[model samples]
Target chain A: MFQKTLTLVLVGVLFMGIATLTYGTFYDKGFAASVTGMMGLGDDEHGEDGDDD
Target chain B: MTKLRLPKAFELLLVWHGLLVGSYTIAYLTAEGAPVLHQFAGYSVLGLLAVRLTAALIAGVRPPWALPLPKASMWKNFGRKLAAGHFSALLGRTPFAPLSGLVILGTLVLVTLSGLAADWWEWEDLHEGLAESSLAVVLIHIAIVSFAPLLKRLNASRADAAATALPRNA
Candidate 1:
């Protein structure tokens, strides 16, 4: 059961990481903002591109 | 012959990906003026990494990739393993085992994330830091992989010698 759970979690992380990367390549600003938010740096004044208006 | 040998297909993929990453690293280190090409190479490396990771994960039983994922209870036993020096044992288990793989995968993820953000936000700090970390990890990874074959041969020879030194049962 633990093995299954670990596998499931890793699989999810792998897929999610790939998906975010692919999406980020095309929509740079949104991807940057989302990743920054995920990193808890969304409140930083330096976060995100200036184009994020 | 229990020595490690990646499948021909996987080997080909590894070689191709290595070349791409090598080219990108070269550009990253020397051609700071060519941001366009550098960025292109970074993205290409990211794409290949994604493909390789996905393939490794999806391919089941036959010719197992031998990815040693951390047990779900790893945190509970982390201190014990550390105290017992099991970390080294874990790393030496296989050519592409979990600990090494986790570093490679995690570094690539960081590089990709920081690279994208660097390009988008015009901030090079995080990207540069992660790129340097990736370079160090990748170099160590290469050294280990290149030594694997020799290590296997040495072990095999030692085993053969030990067997020959034993008295014949028959």
Candidate 2:
């Protein structure tokens, strides 16, 4: 049960990490912001390129 | 073999996101490319993040479970090791885990600050400079995120190997 819980948590991180990692390539134009909802790389400020209007 | 089944298809989606977006970001500033490519790719990446966050938020309402890790100390111990790697080990036991959590939290905070500063910083100087620095912080954060699962996988495999290596009676 514990392992399962941990695995779920890890999965969560993995997906988020994936989101953040992908956004790194193209985050400012609109794709990163629109498609990813601004998933910033660890310390990224993915605001300008995201959904503002 | 225990035959662990993971969400391979979903995981693949993540891998694609990480690779394409990550490559674009690294290549842009370093290689000098057309600005149009940056916007399209960048926003797509952000949209991916939004989707993931929505999933995580939705998952939060599910029932919780416990692990049989022999003792509570094990979870704490794992957290500590993680903290040590992030350089915030002074917080006491379960160093890396808590530190990692804090860093993730800190990343969230910095994101808010930098995002606002990107357009609305009142100070006359250092706006761009501060924004640039934030990019470094994000890069470092992503690196750490990459290290985490790999680190755990290595540890898991090592433990499995050690268990299997014990001498058996003839």
Candidate 3:
């Protein structure tokens, strides 16, 4: 049961990481910005406040 | 060693569950700081929920894909076991699992819907409140799922200890 739970958690983290990376790439924000921006800590470089529209 | 294989339906369910966990975690983590990521995650959650509901409808509300509604009979059986001091009976599936799942599902729906409404209306506060409160439900769900396995392991270890101790006492 523990192993199953752990596997599920790892799979979730993998999906999340990939999705974040994809979002960054799609928006041309690069990896670091995409991550930090997603966390709301990145500085705006495209005149966007990084706020949810 | 044999390869660990799961049924197609089970695999799909695992993937769905994994995605839901990922999306929800991302949504919750980005809620206060990252608006873009938060929105992305929130929309992902909304999409996932839609899929789950649709699947439940199509599957005719069967186990492993159905809405986790705890039946009255389940509660009654669980209560009877507890009343009889049958702790081991609670080591496996229990009524609380479905109950927690039902609560989490309902709470998530409210949170997601309110978030969607907040995009145009003044439902931001309501959404935030529901999201915050939903964390508790999520945590409780986790606890309920984990509790059974944990207790089973504990009981096994205690039994092993007793078995070993019998030789020393003898």
Candidate 4:
């Protein structure tokens, strides 16, 4: 019982973290730019893998 | 300790990644901008969904669990009733909720397909429309996924306790 409850809490917290990260990264246009801007390319640049030279 | 573990693990994972985390990603992606990024998320969402449905289908066809549902194993069942509450919302509320949920979920599938077309064909509204509606659909998906296990656990434990607590004479 304890184990399950603990897992439940942990999972909840883990999901909350993922949610925060997701929301923090992409909730708003400017927010996405400022955050993901620094987090680097998130499949947006397509093939801009710096091999364009 | 048995063949059941694989399918059980898949069910737990389906709830976690396919539903919970997946929905969060979908919601944020749909609500935001960047065609490329949204497409990327949309692709991932489709992939995650495929993994889940495929897993469930395969598991159902075969008796992966000693029990009826592989997800009901007591060993792996651990979670707060809060999640149970969320999962049982539709079933407990009304018979119609499942039907409605199915309709909306179908729309979500369409949203994914439409978004895919929009990505390549550059159809203006399909992209934006699907993207906009996906947030809510994803939310519902995550919620149901998150709570299903909790509900299963709750029912299991309740049955166990009820069985044990029966009077010695009765």
Interface RMSD of each: 14.5, 11.6, 3.3, 8.7
Q: Candidate 3 residues B1-170, lDDT tens each?
A: 88987667656777787788888888887676566677788888899899988988888857678787888988888899989998776787998988898888889999999999988998988998999999999999989999888888898999999999999999
Off by over 4 Å in 3: A37-53, B1-6, B165-170
Ordered by lDDT, highest first, the candidates read: 3, 1, 4, 2
TM-score of each: 0.48, 0.36, 0.85, 0.44
User: Can you write out model 3's per-residue Cα lDDT over A27-49, one digit (the tens) per residue?
Assistant: 64577766776565666433465
The candidates score, on chain A by TM-score, as follows 0.54, 0.45, 0.55, 0.49
Residue B14 in candidate 4 has what lDDT? 30
State the C-alpha RMSD over the true interface residues for candidate 1, after superposing those residues: 14.5
lDDT of each: 0.56, 0.44, 0.81, 0.50
Give the C-alpha miss distance for residue B127 in model 4, angstroms: 2.9
Ranking by DockQ: 3, 4, 2, 1
Model 1 misplaced stretches (Cα beyond 4 Å) = A1-53, B1-8, B60-98, B151-170
Worst 10 residues of 4 chain A by lDDT: A37-46
lDDT of 1 by residue, B1-170 (tens): 68986657544544544444554453353224334334555676677677766766786433334334545456446556767976643334343434565687778877787888886696588787777777788777656554545566787899998898786753
Query: Considering every candidate listed, which one attains the maximal lDDT?
Result: 3
Residue range B131-161, candidate 2, lDDT tens digits: 3655665566455555555566777899988
Best by TM-score: 3
User: Poorest 10 consecutive residues of model 4 chain B by lDDT?
Assistant: B64-73
